[model samples]
Target chain A: MHPVSLRKIAKVYHLDAVTVPALAEVSLDIRPGVFTVLSGPSGSGKTTLLNLIGCIDRPDEGEVIVADQAVQSMSDDALSDFRARHIGFVFQTFNLLPVLTAFENIEYPLVLAKMPAAARKKRVLELLDAVGLAERGDSRPGQLSGGQRQRVAIARALATAPKLVLADEPTANLDSQTGAAIIALMRKLQREHDASFVFSSHDPQVRAEADDVIFIRDGRIAGVEQRTAATQERAAS
Target chain B: MNTWLLALRNLLRNRRRSLATLLAMVVGLTAILLFGGYRSNILYGMETGFVQQSGHLQVQRRGYFLDGSDNPSAYGMPRYREIIDAIQRDPVLAPMAVVVTPTLQLGGIAGNYSAGASRSVVASGLVANERNHMLQWNDYDMISYAQPLALEGAAEDAVVVGTGVARKLQLCAALEVANCRQTPAADAPVEAAATGSPAPDDVLALSALEKAQQPRGAYNRIEMLAATASGAPNVASLTVVKASNFGIKAIDDIYLAMHLAQAQKLIYGAGRPEATAVIMQLRHTAQMPEARARLTALLASDFAGEPLEVLDFQTLNPMYRQTDEFMASMFGFIALLIGVIVLFTIGNTMGTAVMERTVEIGTLRAMGVRRGGIRRLFMCEALLLGAIGSVVGLTVALMVSWFINHSGWAWTPPGYSYAYLILVRVWQDVPLLVGSVLGMIAVTVASAWWPASRAAKLQIVDALRHA
Candidate 1:
């Protein structure tokens, strides 16, 4: 089954008396265990779609099903549990709690899951090594470089082995070299953890590394293109 | 790491704001504790004073507390000595009774016959050694001691009059009294007697022969006049041994203390000697209720048909209760003021912290922490501040109280004519210390509730976008 599927989902925002339709009747399916990109320019509903798939926001109409469960039907606590177990997210700013170290930030989701300390520590250490931040585990977010913070964020998203990881503008604030490194690290982690990575980006280089690219404009999906086996293999490599 | 550790770290992120909030809490808490201790001392000091003077409980005739001062002999307990003995020997009260004795109250006119001046006075006749023992009751560790009466082995006719009486009698010089002021009218009688001039009726009525018998200003001798039990006038010649200050203006103006035998003779000559009150000083002030209960039971059964009623020191002296209530009200008002200050201080700090951490809160929520967890995190931080402030505040309060106790500062309280130690009592009072701590914590948590709730109810996506 697809990790996430949306059917004619819509979202709106009200600023004072003005109503802005951020997303309208968007339909998509995210293939399991693939690196996908929702490619669009600013205010193009790409991040809105990522938020809907992450179960962080609700749609005004239609259905959003994640891990084969309709997310909109769950209570807030149940939805939180669902998100903690089945989904993870990465922000453009790498929103790690500033007070916690990189290791503690990666262990946060597992702590939410109430994993025992021994198991949480082992899992956090393994994820830190996987993200090339094992030795920098004790460094706070303020002490880490942009590329290093993004690597730590990727490890945190995959810490619970979630079925889907949604990122919004994952490289918008990074230098080109750091951006390319983060993109490569995310792709490698997706392959290693076998979790679907659906991130929103406007960068052509970023979209070029995706197994699937969905283009959207004006709150509606414009197109979806799936790479061939050779192209997917090359992208994965 | 644990949630508390996370909360502590979050607080440490903004050290200045957190310290400001903590300082507000600590200052408020210390002020509250210090005032609370001072209030305790006032009540304790007054309690010790009353117990030392009038014993913890007194057994008096019915209607005595209301009207006996007007004519105390009418309500006199004729067999008070036997009653005191029974109380001292009773199985239940024997251990608690530190001193059980009888006191005689009489109203009379004290006249310096040689000076040709007379003023109305109220006198207490006390067993000198027993009265000295009663003056030594210091149950709350007041660190104060009363000077024993100087009439312990003096003649039965010796007496002590207040400085006010000495001033009115124009005998301040003879008694070696200090701070005594004599009115010009006080010399009118003596001056008239010396010049053979006309004088007021009180001075003119005294026989010239009596005034001539004693030299003017040569001796501290006074004549006491009181109506005997049969309503016949009786007079006694007393040698004034001392003029003491009773620390109350009105009581001092009319105060006299003499040996019991002399007072009984002056009031009930050739008849059964009686006592106005059976003073029972207890080993501890806390034992008053038990001692009173047992004494009342004894009076009802063993000394029936005497119209006797038992009264505790607090009940007998309503001023103590009034002062206590007044102090309590003032303390409550000050405590409320400080509590409000602390409340708003902590609230503002938490409010600012919530605003600064909006995106962090959203991240926590996205990482699967429930709203309750968010609320608890902030509340934990606030409570930690309160707990630390209380402990440190109490420590500071105790230190300050100890310093003041040893500072030798003294000030007269209301209704007192002399100054007393400015003492603050706190260490042995567990209820005050524990209640202050809990009250501070409760205020801290309550203050944080609104901010914590706001943090919890934040829209995740909106918070993530906060700048």
Candidate 2:
């Protein structure tokens, strides 16, 4: 079964009697164990779509079902619980809390999930090691490179072992090489954990690394491409 | 593990801002403590003065206060035993001494030997020991009145003159009134012998009549002669022995405690040896209230048919109330001013804090923290600030108060001739201190409400967008 499904999702922003559609009748499905990239220019509703799937934002008129539970019908508290249980998110700005170290940043989601401190610490250390940042765990985000910070962000997103992880422009602020490295790390992590990775991006490198791609233009999906197993085997070889 | 630690960390996230808030709280608290302490001290000092100088209560003849002429013998408490018994029975009451004395208000001419001039002076008769007791309570020790010095070949009738009279007369020890007497000059040969005498017997008698007809000063020497009421003279001589220089110097101008027995005998009569009032001395002033109540009850029961009045020091000295009222008003004004300043400081600090954390608050809300949690976080911060401020301020205030008390400042209220060197009083449970501290905390917490509620109600999307 698909991990996330959006049916006829519409989002409208009302600003001073002007009705501007942020997302219009959008419908999509996200399956497990796939790196799906939504590629669009700015204001193309890619981030809006990601927000809806992540349960951080609800559709104005339509249904959002994640892991077979209708998210649009859930109350705010229920949505928060749903998000904590099934979804993880990474922002474009690498929005790390300045006061927290890399390890603490990774542990933040588990804390939100109300996990046991000892378990959280163990999971945080494991994730830090997996992200090749074990040495930098105690260093603040400000003291790390862009690649290392993005690695920390990805580790934080994966801390709770959520079914779906959404990244909004995760490589927007990194150098091309660092961005590529971060994308590679995310893809590797996704494969190892069997977690579905959905990211909105305009970076070609990020788009090239996707197992499937959804092309969006002006708040509507233009095309959808899926890499078959044969194609994955060829790319791997 | 506690969310409060997270809240505290958030406060310290911006070091400069947090320091500013802390500094403001410290200042507000310090001012509150100092002003509060000082006001409490003044009030306590005045209360102590009142309690020490005047017994908590006094009892007198019911009519004595109004008419000022109630006779002591007329309203004497015959049931004094019952009064003492009642006082002993009440646990909350303490009993002191019961005494009786006489008082008189008289105006008469006072003369000096050297000038032979007399001035009108006011005289009051007091019981000697009772007067001494009153003076001692008033903190006066060096007080004196005269007893007559012996003179040979002189009239026994004599007077103890006041310092004012002594200074005016220029009379010293061993001075004789007869030597100092001023006689009217011959009066022009007694008006030329008041027409010529006719015969030897007539001539002698006429000379005696002429001498008698000449105007003479009332007496060669004036005396405050002690006598029986029926005009039988009992001569007793007195001289000024010692004097007092403190506590109402004008008291030296008036005679006091001139032998109540002698006064009563002289003023009323030998047979009517009665007093006008009673003066009581007590071991402690605290015993006065019960003693007064018991005495009043006793008098009412014993002298049921008679009219009497009771008076304490408060009634005798109207200045006590005036002084108390003035001090209270002054303290009240100071408290009000301090309260206003503290409220403003706390409000401003909390407001500034809210303003600085707009984006952080928005982020937390977007992170799915409940609005109630947000409110709790802010309120907790305010409470923390208040608690710290109160503690630091109180310590500072206590120290300042201690220093001021130990510094030994000399203070003199208006209309008083003598100055007192005293320390500031300390009253730990003064209502103002407790009320003000609580008031400060309340003000601080309430002040945080508008800003905290505003933060709580912020739209998550817009807050996340806040820079």
Candidate 3:
């Protein structure tokens, strides 16, 4: 079953008197338990499309159905609740609250969900151990390395056990080795948790780790490639 | 728990800004408390001075105030004893004293004879012991016989004189001969008198004659006869016994006390010895209204067809009101200035904090914290700052006030000659401290509200993007 469905989605920004189209009539369906990468060069509307799917921004004219709820018609507050319940987000900057420790950052989503204290503690500890940062839970974001910080962000994103995770260039700041490790961790968590992971990236390492690839040029989808078929095609060529 | 903990953590994250705001609140609250305390002290002092020195009510002969001649003989209230007795029985009135002293006031010829000449002076007489009591009650010293030299034999009419009177007489020593210049002969013309030797002025003459004729520096010894009751005379004279460097110099120099019986006898004669009005002390001033009303009714009924006036300190003395109003205005002005300073400091500090924490506030909002929660967070911080500041400020103020009270700083009030060390009165100052502290808290919280609300209302998107 599809976890996220978008039909003819569009987003426009009014800069002064100019109307800039960020996304134009885009349509797609994302199923559960699959790793998908949306790949494009700069200004190809990859981030905008991710933002729409993440419910942080709304498409000007479109139907965005997440977990069978029509997100396009939801109020800002309702949409916030929806995002908190179903969509976990990872950003390029590893947006951890500087004042909070790794454990606190991971527990933040659970707090927003108002989970019981015991449950929150249990979930946070589980995620911290899962991210291999159980020993570093008390350390603030500034005390952690870039790879560790990204790992903490991923742990925080999955703490609420969200069904759909949107990662916008999550490994853009990490070294190739750290990047591959983070991607592998995310894929492993997805398979175990039965959650779908969607990454907007131009990085080859990120693209290679995906199960399916959606390529875009300008503001339109250029093509889609399945991993097994693409591998066979590449070998044949 | 998580939101509040996050809020607290965020506050500590920006240490310098938070500290700056806290410091401003503390200083503002402290100043307010101190100023309020000072004002209360001054007001209490003034009120106590008023109540103790001046009774809530006074009874006088109807025309005594207007004529400036309130002699007991001329306007005697025949039932003076009855009135005093009646007032003393009342429960609410705190009457301190009920005195019926005679006053013999006259612009008369006073003289002292020596071998060379006799000098002229102004003489006044009062009921002695009672006069001394009145002076002492108002914190004045008793007079001594050594200060005014007594005359002998034919010149036994020796009198105590004010410094001003002494200067006028030009007496080198007490009871020494100071001659009066004789009046020029009017019929012989001014030219003849200027040419003739000025005749020696008569030392024995009446002040009544001095009034009838315009005499030229002629000294008269008005042998004013004052009768005294058998034993020690009730009159006690008040000379410049020991002139202090402080307090009411005019009364010190000019006042004279004589026996009440003597004054009544000399001024009113033997058959009619009476007092103009009676003074009474009650239990307390709070009972003054009922006491006054009861007294007035009694006087009206008992002394039918007679005119009497019941006057209070507020009515008899105009200066008291002026002093009270001036002190009140001074206290008010000081309080206002302090309050303004506190308000501005807190406002500025909170404004800076709100500006710096835009992003943190946005994050909280995005995390499902409501606008009201943000405002509450800021208010709590303000309250904490105010509470801490008030305590510190009160401690400092108490210490300073203590130092001042014990500093041995002395001052002589205007119209006074003696100096007294300054003292801080705690009973009068505690309320001031409380009021000021509360005022500081109020102003600090009020000043912080607008800025905190502004921070709470910041757009989440823009704030999240803020660098």
Candidate of highest TM-score:
1
Judge the docking of candidate 3 as incorrect, acceptable, medium or high: incorrect
**DockQ rank, highest first?**
1, 2, 3
Best by lDDT: 1
Measured against the true structure, the TM-scores of the candidates, in listed sequence, are 0.91, 0.68, 0.66
lDDT of 2 by residue, A126-219 (tens): 9999999889999988899888888888898888898788898999888888888888899899999899999999887887778888988888
Quality of model 3 by C-alpha lDDT: 0.62
What candidate 3 gets wrong by more than 4 Å, as runs, is A1-11, A14-19, A23-39, A44-89, A108-119, A162-167, A191-200, A209-237, B1-11, B14-30, B55-355, B410-428
DockQ of each: 0.73, 0.21, 0.19
Between candidates 1 and 2, name the one with more favorable DockQ: 1
Q: Which is the better candidate, 2 or 3, if ranked by TM-score?
A: 2
TM-score (C-alpha, index-matched) for candidate 1:
0.91
**lDDT tens digits by residue: candidate 1, B339-428:** 999999999999999999999998888878888889999999898888888888888888998998899999986666678878888787
Q: lDDT per model, in order?
A: 0.86, 0.62, 0.62
Write the number of the candidate with greater DockQ, choosing between 1 and 3: 1
List per-candidate RMSD values in Å: 3.3, 10.1, 9.4
lDDT tens readout by residue for model 3, B1-467: 45456556766777776676656555555544445544444444434344333345656679875573433345555555556665565443324334323334433322222112222322344444443333223211111112221211112223445443333333323324234232233223222443333322331233224333434332322133222323211221122221111134554444332344444554454555555545443334455677678767866776667678876655655666676677568767866776677677767766776777776665555444556767887777666657766776667767766777678887765665346455544334556666777877888788778888888777655565577
Ranking by TM-score: 1, 2, 3
* lDDT for each residue of candidate 3 in A1-237, tens digit (9 for 90 to 100): 688888998888788999988888789888677888999999898988887787666789989888888888887567667777887777677778888999988888888898999999999999999989989999999999999999998998898888898898988989889988998899899887889999999988788777778887777778887778568346334
